[model samples]
Target: GESVGLHLPTLSVQEGDNSIINCAYSNSASDYFIWYKQESGKGPQFIIDIRSNMDKRQGQRVTVLLNKTVKHLSLQIAATQPGDSAVYFCAETPGGGGNKLTFGTGTQLKVEL
Candidate 1:
């Protein structure tokens, strides 16, 4: 996917369908990864998280998958709804980077009715 400089990546899905959002991280040393959902004009809310030691984790209606070897992560949403339409972010905490969280360019999920 192309990063449009300051613009969030987008994933459009029909209401009641499943949605998948993707992200790539540059830090191979990142130990923890979190997925956040942000409604317009609001701070991002925690959706799910996964540790480097785990390849996959599940939450209510959501899932986080980590691919350490490829430095990639993904969020899966089941039965997407209009209320789920929002900007999603993937954040990472490097092994020794203190408490700093590095966020990827967000992905906006638009649920179409």
Candidate 2:
């Protein structure tokens, strides 16, 4: 049985500081990973993604890191802002089949002024 979970339920960071959200997946076969951000009433928005073949991928203001050795994934946000306040989720597709995505419980990101 494969499952995904977050290390922390909530993460608070000061505005302009860097924020790191961590997730652990039980499926070592999972090859694709995605990070999503969901606001108050909006659907989860794609933030960044990485593949097992790569150790790290960077997007506009975010970065996704994959550690296959430890079956760990992480999302990092640079210059955290109030707008970045939201629930962040990490998802992974088992075996890279892209058939389904198993999402974590999600971590609340709070950006303090």
Best candidate per TM-score, number?
A: 2
The weakest ten consecutive residues by lDDT in model 2 span 92-101
Candidate 2: which stretches are off by over 4 Å?
96-98
Per-prediction RMSD in angstroms?
A: 3.6, 1.0
What is the number of residue pairs that collide in model 1? Answer: 0
lDDT accuracy of residue 41 in candidate 1: 90
lDDT for each residue of candidate 2 in 18-61, tens digit (9 for 90 to 100): 99999999998888889999999999998888888999999888
Q: TM-score, each model?
A: 0.90, 0.96
Give lDDT tens digits, candidate 1, residues 1-113: 22212133888899999998888887778898889899999999999999899999999999888888867788899999999999998888878758878787788899999
lDDT of the candidates, in the order given: 0.84, 0.93
Q: lDDT value for candidate 1?
A: 0.84
Query: Candidate 2, overall lDDT?
Result: 0.93
Please give the TM-score that candidate 2 achieves against the real structure. 0.96
